[model samples]
Target: MGAPARKQRSGSRMGARLTVWASDHGRAAVGALGRLARSRVASIMTAGVLGIALALPAAFLLLLDNLERHAGDWDDGAQVSLFLQADVSPEDQAALAASLAERTSIRRTEVVSPDEALEEFQAVAGMDDALAFLDENPLPPLVIVYPVTGTPADEIEALTAEMGEHEAVDTARLDLEWVQRLQAIMELSRRAAWLVVILLAAAVIMVVGNTIRLAIENRREEIVVTKLIGGTNAFIRRPFLYEGAWYGIIGGVLATVLVEGGRLLLSGPLERLASLYQTGPLLTGLGLQGTLALWAAGIALGLCGSWLAVGRHLADIEPR
Candidate 1:
């Protein structure tokens, strides 16, 4: 009988231990969740602010990326137009094209006769009647040259200068304005992106900090009681840290949703704009990497904010 009783008592002890363990974990989880849910208004407000802050920078980044992609595809075929001298014959222009085509840097060359140039100008300028009234075509023949891929800019410029110095070539024009402007714009966008990221990060920190401060104020009595009952500072701080983490996680998710929603909203209009310009699809919004970074940032902000709050306020709240 004694042995059976002892076995029953041991089983009861095990069951009680299991129950207590389960209850503590459950309560802790509930406490963390409840704390977040209780501050619904504050949580939603903070999350919305974070979403807007993240969205602005993210939209700017997407635009910058698309612009860079378009710039990168700029026609690598550097154009060099050689205007023929007034006295240069059609045969002479043809010979020049053949000669330039033999150079390794020259991918292709073509000679446009004076009559063809006049017709092209007339069509483009919508002045066919004006051109017909003239006794003879005033436009000179042109030798247009295109360089192969990997042709250095300096080499192209030198080639243009050499062509312009020729007896039959009156002038040579190379359009390098596109490349210079694209490069400048890309640099400016890069700098602006960095600035946006910095400002957004500071905004996140402030949001988390304020949230943690409010949490501390709400839980002042709980913290005081815990300290009085021999609960370690770490144990008391654990739930607040968890609260911060929850804020970060929720904020990150909210931001992602906002970003994706904005992308969907703009996609149709963007596609239409691309079609009008005869361009391929343009990418927008945060990609997988960006999404992951946002999540990590939110979690880090939460942890840091909680740490700062507990470290500063907890020390001053010790029970006398």
Candidate 2:
């Protein structure tokens, strides 16, 4: 009976301790918010700075996403053209096209006979009169192949090499050099984004740290009094941590608003431009995941900034 009574009392004590802890945190949160309310201009100014820092990187990242999507929409890396031997007749070319249609690697094939190729060159190159003197056609039969989507570059190159070895194929060419260049550009853009993020993150920490240091200075006398009255550092530190967290959360929200507003403002012009480029519309604003990540990043920066400030400055303030 005594053992069960002791167990019950232990459980009750645990529950009461948890309740007290929660109450303290709740009070701290309210106190922190109230402090911000008291100095609205300063809080807004700090948060605005953080928001702008976040928005710059976010905008560039969204632009890169749109460019990537536009490139992908054109199936830029999904085609290879085969120019057949001059001796391969139109009938043979037609038969080769039929055979290519059944191959898994080749999604679609179009056969351009020598005559049609010559006619196109005559029309586009303005060389019809010069070509009229020739007795035989100089252009060869061509087969334009559209590869299945998402086919690896290596596989496509291998297929091109194999097709070039065919007796009927004079040459197989895949104009993927441009695609490679685009991919390189995308890689560079990604690196730039990371660089921007790193610089902005440091800026955020510094901004929050400076703001927190000022707050600590403003309450120096109160801190000294608390120390004299035996208030533990943890107890004294709670409100400041909560205050920093509030700043971070608000800053993140402001950043989201700024980013989305910019996206909306640019949507009309970008959508029209995308139509001209014959790609899907430009990438949209930050989705749920991105918004949440922004908020999380902001909170982390605020906490770290506050922690650094408090650790350095709190040690210097004493009853004396």
Candidate 3:
């Protein structure tokens, strides 16, 4: 045959072989799915375990995300209290508050006169009678400054320091201890979430691997016969790999359902609570991208687990 004809024939053979390979893979995948459906209860039980394992971490991370968002709201609520000099006049105090309020960093400011400050203290401390004994009020006028929401903590601190330096001011204090504590808590929660993710991911792999190993043993005789009849190792391994992939896909779907279901269950209570506080939604679930990523993770873990099981156990099944 001429060179061109021979090349064409070779190409046709390659294409034909590829088509057959693809067809076999399609059949193996469908067969694996059908086998699982035949044993519905056991398949569901295995998938359920994997679903729960995956869901736990996803739920925790979602909670953490909500918390961080709420904490940011708290950051906006933080206030700075400025104590005026004892001798500073009420007019000067009001003027200082007004000046502070005009600054871009300051959201607004309230001037509290000595009498108002003392009255508030007496009400809170229940020391009205004790304070009556003093000839003159000892409390200083106050300027309560609310920083613009979402202002950086460092900028807030600098603003506080600037307020304290004002001629009419005695001291400026920003109660940020609570904010610091919240930051520490968020950091700890993030680390804990990561740890849970790692542990649960491993558990999922082990679960799938053990299940695949059991399947390999149950089909040992069939595998031996196939090998004796000239089946390649890849051919024997294909169905099990598809089986593992199906398990992963199912588990991933189940996990998504569990997480979303929990979110739905909590949504009403959370919405009511947020309404009471006059805030928006307090919790959010994994959106489209996140759901896809979770499904991909499930498929990857399933494939890894099945590959490990097949690689180890398939080698031991011989035609002896």
Candidate 4:
């Protein structure tokens, strides 16, 4: 009799555990589904709004990235032209080119003879007829210098100044002003991209909050009955929070789709533009990390918006 009683007690404990587990999982699943059914139309509308909002900033960021890449190619190949005086001998010009090339900061240097320089100018300027009447070619020899990667602008400027002081060098000019302007523009675009993202996130939260507020108003009577039946505030809030989360997850997915679709739509025009400039293709889509961040941001906005709505309205519908 004692052994039978112990066996029955063990069976009862196992059954209790199973029942608790099943109840918890069933409630979670039903809460999610209930939230979905309660505001299907509102959820869809909010998701669409969020999708469009998120896509705008993402697309702008893609455009900025492509522009930066195109700018980078020109920056990496920054050049300086050293014009030698006509009195400087060819041997001295060659020696100057060799000396500059030997410097750690200088990547490569080439000296162009005076006659060759004249030919190049005439060909480029389309002024061969004007040049034929000259008694002698008046162009100076040139030393073209390429700086090493990651060279500082100040250092390059100093080097140019030093080169200009040389008796053999008539003029020295660094071609880096355009690069500086491009870098400034890229920085401005980056800041603007972030600002746009923040605004869009706020927009998403507002949309979700308004929709949840309407839901609470519609279910005011049900909430009152739950309070009378002894349901805790947490129990009443769980389904609404779950609903907000669902909206966020779905909205994130939709936003990503919109961003990708927009990229595809613009890719052809962008390619044509790049071809005109002889540049590599511009990067136009979010990377894995960016995509993940976007999804998480959407979900968080949805959850916070729903919480705000529930907190503001739930206490008003008491047992009375």
Candidate 5:
């Protein structure tokens, strides 16, 4: 009976200690939030700065994503044209076109006979009078081949080279200079987005760090007193960490709002512009995954900033 009673007492003491710890941390977190509320204007202003800094890069990256999505519509998917050897029989041209059409990479193929080619040139160039002087039809049979979905410009060039090696193919041309240029521009945009994000992420860290430093200064006396009364550094650090977390989370929310808000504002005008060209695909806003990532980045940066600030300045106010 005595041993059981002793065990019960030990359990009660441990439970009591756990409760005390829970309340201490809870109170610290709440107190830190209350402090931010007290200085609402300054806190809001600092968060706004961080939000704008984070939003710029995020918006640019979003724009790049949208552009990449619409790259195919921007005339980058040019077709390949194959001309058969002049002496190649009509049966050979048809066979070649039929075989090329069977391949998955070739979206479709159209054969333009010599007579049709001559008629098109005559219509476009108004060269019927000039062509009357020729002894025979000089145009070779033509095979126009389009690329399948997701086929890139380089792959089309490679396909063209492979086609030219065929016995019946006189020449295979894939004039995708414009597509190549667009790909280059897209690559540059990707690099630029990363560069801007890196620069802006550093700015976010600085903004949060400075804000936390000011908060620490305001609580210098309280922190010193807590230390004098034998409060551990970890106990004192909890509020500041929570405070930084609040700032980061709130800033991230503000940044996401700014990005989506701008996207919303532009959607109408953008839709009208796309509609003018008869393209049905509309501008898109951030999806669920992207929105969550934005919030996560904001919170993480906030915690890091707070941790850095507390580590640097909290130790300096050593009850002196």
Candidate 6:
């Protein structure tokens, strides 16, 4: 009975201590928020800087994503033109196209006879009088081959080379230079965006740390007095950590707002541009997942910055 009673008492004490700890944390968090509210202008200015920093990379990445999506739509137009030898018969050209169509890499093949090619050139070039002087059509029979969707650029190039080697084909031309250039630009933009993100993240940490350090300096006397009264470092540190967290949360929210606002502003112009190409909307904003990640990143940076400031500055403040 005595042992059981002792265990119960111990449990109660532990629960009481936990409740006190949680209450203290809650109070600290609320108090820190109140302090920020009291200094609206300064807090807003600091958070505004952070928001701009966070939004730049986020916006760049979002733009890159949208461009990549638009580029994918362009991929459907990528096709290889296989110009057959002049000597190849119509039957042979059709048979070659049929064989290429059956391959896994080739989606489908379209055959254009020499006469059709000449007629198309004449229609577009308006050179009927000049062509009438020629006894024979100059254009060879053509086979246009479209690769499977989502095929790699290298694979398409390889397929082009393979098709060019065929006996009936004079040359295989893949008109994908624009697509390749677009992909290269996308890769470069992605890397540049990441670089900007890293640099801005470092800037955010430094800004938060400096801000927290100034705060600690302003409260030097209070901290010293608390220490003299037997307050532990952890207890003194709680409110400052909360202050940093609040800064981060506000900054993250501001960043989201800025990004969305920018997206809305650009959406109209982007839609107009996409309409010229008969494509769908080209602008995509930071969705739910991205917004949450931005918030999480801000919070983490804030906590880290504040922890560093508190650990360094708080230790220097001692009861004298």
**TM-scores across all candidates?**
0.73, 0.93, 0.85, 0.81, 0.87, 0.92
lDDT agreement with native, every candidate: 0.80, 0.87, 0.90, 0.83, 0.86, 0.91
Best by TM-score: 2
* Worst 10 contiguous positions by lDDT, candidate 3: 91-100
Q: Model 4 misses residue 17 by how many Å?
A: 11
Which residue segments of model 5 deviate by more than 4 Å?
A: 1-22, 72-76, 122-136, 152-154
**Every candidate's CA RMSD:** 7.5, 2.0, 3.1, 4.8, 3.1, 2.1
In model 2, state the lDDT of residue 258.
Answer: 93
lDDT of 6 by residue, 121-198 (tens): 999999989999998888999999999877889999999998899988899899889888878888988999999999
Q: Give the TM-score of candidate 4.
A: 0.81
Over 14-72, each residue of candidate 5 has an lDDT whose tens digit, in order, gives: 99999998999789778878988999999899889878987898899898888888886
Candidates 1 and 4 compared: the better one by lDDT is 4
Number of the candidate with higher lDDT, 2 or 3: 3
lDDT score of residue 297 within candidate 5: 89
TM-score of 3: 0.85
Residues 96-188 of candidate 4: C-alpha lDDT, one tens digit per residue: 999999999898998899888888898899988899999997888899998886687788889899888988888999998877787788899
**Given candidate 6, what's the lDDT at residue 290?**
94
Ranking by lDDT: 6, 3, 2, 5, 4, 1
When summed lDDT is taken over every stretch of 10 residues in candidate 1, the lowest stretch is 69-78
How close to the true structure is residue 26 of candidate 5, measured as C-alpha lDDT?
A: 88
Q: How accurate is candidate 5 locally (lDDT)?
A: 0.86
